[model samples]
Target: MDKSLEKSLTLWLKQQQTVCAGYLKLTVLFGILTGLCLLAQAYTLASVLDGLIMQQLSLLTFYPELIALLSLTIFRALLAYAKESSGFIAGKKLRAQVRQTVLNKLISLGPSFINTKPAGTWANIVLEQIEDLHDFYAKYLPAMMLAGFIPLIILAAIVPINWLSAMILLVTAPLIPLFMVLVGMGAAEANRKNFSALQQLNGHFLDSLRGLRTLILFHRQQAEIDKIANVSNDVKQRTMSVLSLAFLSSAVLEFFAAISIAILAVYFGFSFLGHLEWGSFSLLPPTEHRLSLFSGLFVLLLAPEFYQPLKDLGTHYHAKAKAIGAAESLVTLLNIQDSSLTSHITTSLIASSKASHTKIDLKTWELEANNLKVFTHDGECLLGPISFTISGQQKLAVVGASGSGKTTLVNLLLGFLPYEGSLKIQGIEFNQLDLSHWRNNLAWLGQEPQLFHGTLMDNLRLGNQTLSTEKAWELLAKANIDDFVSQHPLGLKLSIGEQAAGISVGQAQRIALARALSRDANVFILDEPTASLDSASADAITQSLTKETTAKCLLIVTHKLSQLGAMDTILVLEKGQLNSSGSYDELMAQNGLFCQLNAQTAYDIDLQTSLGLNS
Candidate 1:
């Protein structure tokens, strides 16, 4: 084996000591079985050969050897079956355990970690890489160890009969492994590259699929196809390179093993033809007696089996490398720190001595954002150094341009992201309040609602797992979606296609709104909650939202200028800073961006009507 390859394998094995040790024990047991089975099979062959050479081939006389050989063969098959079953089970157990550990960590890390990572890459890690470890842990590793050990045991047994034969086997045994290691080193590198390329391809494919509609609208369908093809081609080339390396490694190992066995055969044939004799050591002869002849033939029979494991072992190493590459990515992702401000918040619902300064009752929940400023990882500023407060039974509207950091501010308040300043509940700093308790008080409706593939009832019930059918129907009614949903033959039991496909955009939003209402939170943060609706639908939703806000702290983000008039307080944001905070009349009096933007919308409507463009 090349020195560098040997070093790499040793280092890799050491890092995986605990998991590898379990496989080692299994391999040891398998090795013992293999040795015993081979010895019995060879002994039976020797007995049959001895009888045949003497012209005494009687079934009755050879009955004991025949029966013993039959029993060993049966035992060997049983042992092999047990080993395979147990190894597969162990691999499965390890995969599940590792995947579970990573999943728990990812959940704690939450949205921030997810935002930074490509969803496709995470999916590949959890699904593909985790599954590949099965072959390496269950089959290849154990076989490799057994292959190495069994040969030595066979050599020990055969050495006393003919030192020359034993020497040849011992010396040639190293050659197969040496060739395997040299070839396998190149394969490992290729495998790592292939695995990386495959993950990138997956990420690109997912990204393209998610934006297919947008791409088609821009007349970029052909361009998207070209992009996908590029990624596919890269993956294909890497895969073929790895396969080629594996083929070459297998060929080299097989050739060496065959050549070594042929040389031994030649030596044995020459010795027999020349009538060679040993002048010394009656116990160890250069020429074969009946026992030596039987042992040599048996050794020859077992020779190929000794090298077969090494070949199989080298092939499995690629699977191990691929698994490790995936595992490494997952581990890094799971190691991400919970950088969210919510991490400091307690998870309990009940207010205690820690929350006393907030002056909130155990059942009361109020939220306040105090001069909170958020920045991206690259230090691009998001939300304000502006203060805001929303006490019970108040509705606040945050109006801004497309990129004016409205979502960032809401996320900060929700404790999904860390902030520069502080947020408090009922006058207490947000960090002191229980995050889980705080979350329980909220019903958030994002512009794009994510409805997982399932029945409508299934998706709705995800809001509160214990929600009764009666409660769900009531929520659907309140969200104004009950009429549309009930008209379908399947009603609440209808299965929504993946990500709520086969449903209107407005319906999807309302379904999510229904889920949020079903939770019965004391707080609601709606981001463009009426964006997908027509004027009449928007009016109905606004009325429902306004009624729901009577006893809760409501924070809605919108670009719809007319909705600002209904809010108790209208907070206008511009260039990542809060511009105005007051009633609509007060903001209009200031004649700032809010007034100008509203005026522009009014003019556009009037112009469209004059040109007969209004719907």
Candidate 2:
């Protein structure tokens, strides 16, 4: 019923032919061959019946006719196999291409794009929804063509023998497809709702699984179960509705096909009884009053075969309905990047650390932002108008209250969003730099270590395999994870869990720190690196990073506000604007937010006192 959904489906169907027409054409060829074979079988069977019954010929004399029928059946069977195999290959290739396009689109859009939708919805798009389109490509699309042509072939064979029967078959044929279109509209809508309900239910289930321990701790597991049950019931009802429409369409098709066949049968029967002769076509020099037994039997035999393609199409049409439902959602997701609202990217995703300083250009390691502003899709500025410049191996800390644009600024620096003003890196416009290469030159460590399931050494290299074992071991000692590694039998070869599941959170942060240090990066962006740990563990991580900061320009976005003795400059941000920029001593004298934050500092500020600012 939705015009937009119907329009999108039409456009999407047109796209499939261009992408895999070579494979899909084979499905059409085999389907037509099978139709020809069906007509041949009818003719052979009718001839054999006529010879034995009307001509009084012995079965042995008509053995060739019998053999022809058997051969046609065998040939049709082989064509059926080729048809099915070709259809499968067509669907498989199309799905592979669709999935690859989806993946590449997602990659270009990155995490900011992905986080907007439910994980389960994305999984459904990538897995279930694209997969649901197989039937459309493999069965429904081919059937669409065969249904049109195959019936015409049957009509061609029938018209010379009995035009009235062919007329009855042709006129009633449109009714099945006409009514099917009406039912299919409802089926498509129901399937869409069913897929939506499935996505929601799956998302809720995965969330519940992830939070099961917390749910049990709060004694809400049973309530969660009840909620899931209600959603599951919605999915069940939607599924039944779709099946009900499919059955209704089939019932309508069968009813019309039976009525059409019966009309032909009754005409042939009355003529045989010499009660009617008006409907029978005259094929001889003298007009025939009644039909011969052979002609009548042949037409009767081809009756079911006449409506067969339409019936086959009616069955496969459900696949079209299902694919329409899935394609509608997938089209929206696939078009996200092309949408005007999301495509403006202004900053570089990569940058060389300010201190590296080897490029030929002036201020090659400098970063400058003048009146820079970043607005979200909804037009609200998350970071703005604040400008700063950094050069040399300057260690700076950005301190702000919650919602003071710390995360937004980090994203802007990392080139996740578009900016409205001037941004320069290493004397080059930030927008002109290669983001991937710039990212390779910098190191980033977050609060929770991003550990995948692999050897400890692999996690340490962080996808760059050029780091030597000796360098990795040195970083391990610096981060205080060497003690644990030495105690373990595998050392760096020890397997870590996905997201550091096998290791404690404290130990995980240490490994992340070690990994960051091993990169020998020129600029390190450490964001809330100690947020999850206790005072002792936090102090240990802070101590480990301070010793490794001399050669690199380190930017820390932190709430700790402690140990400022080692910081060269700390910029205090209030809301989205810069409030103050000073050293620990200057800020303490200025009595700004930095001073108040330092006043509340709970960690031992002198824990890493020896690693003071050198520049």
Off by over 4 Å in 1: 1-24, 54-59, 111-120, 206-223, 274-291, 338-362, 365-394, 413-415, 418-441, 565-571, 578-589, 596-615
Compose the digit string of candidate 1's lDDT tens values, residues 1-615. Answer: 244653554454335435546755775586578677877788687767666664457767878888888888888888777778767766776677767766765554445446675778778777887676567667766766777777777777666666677778778878877777677665545665676787888888888898899999999999989988998999999988877877887788778888988987777666556554431123643243423455457667766765666666666666655555444455445433322223432231112334333324524656676667775533445666877777677789988888888887776656565456667666677656566666777789887788988999999988899988898888888888999888999989988988788898889988998898777787788888877765466667888888866767788987667756778898888878888888888888888998987887667657866886543
Query: Cα deviation in Å at residue 152, candidate 2?
Result: 1.3
RMSD of 1: 5.4
| Candidate closest to the true structure, highest lDDT | 2
lDDT of prediction 1: 0.71
lDDT of 2 by residue, 1-615 (tens): 487767778578659756778878999999999999988888888778877887889999978888888999999999999999999999998999989888876665555556777777789889999999898989888988998889899888878777777888889889888878877767877888888998998888878887888999999999999999999999999999999999998998898889888888888888889997765566732356678777788788888887878888998889988888888877876664345344563432322232232332321377887888875533457777788887647878888888888777776666565567787876666766666666666778765558889989989888356888888888888877789998999988999876576788777877887888877467788877776565565666677677687756788888887655677888788888888888878988988788777766542344434344111
Model 1 alpha-carbon miss at residue 44, Å: 3.6
Among all candidates shown, the one with the greatest TM-score: 2
* Model 1: residue 99 alpha-carbon error in angstroms: 3.1
Cα lDDT of all candidates, in order? 0.71, 0.77
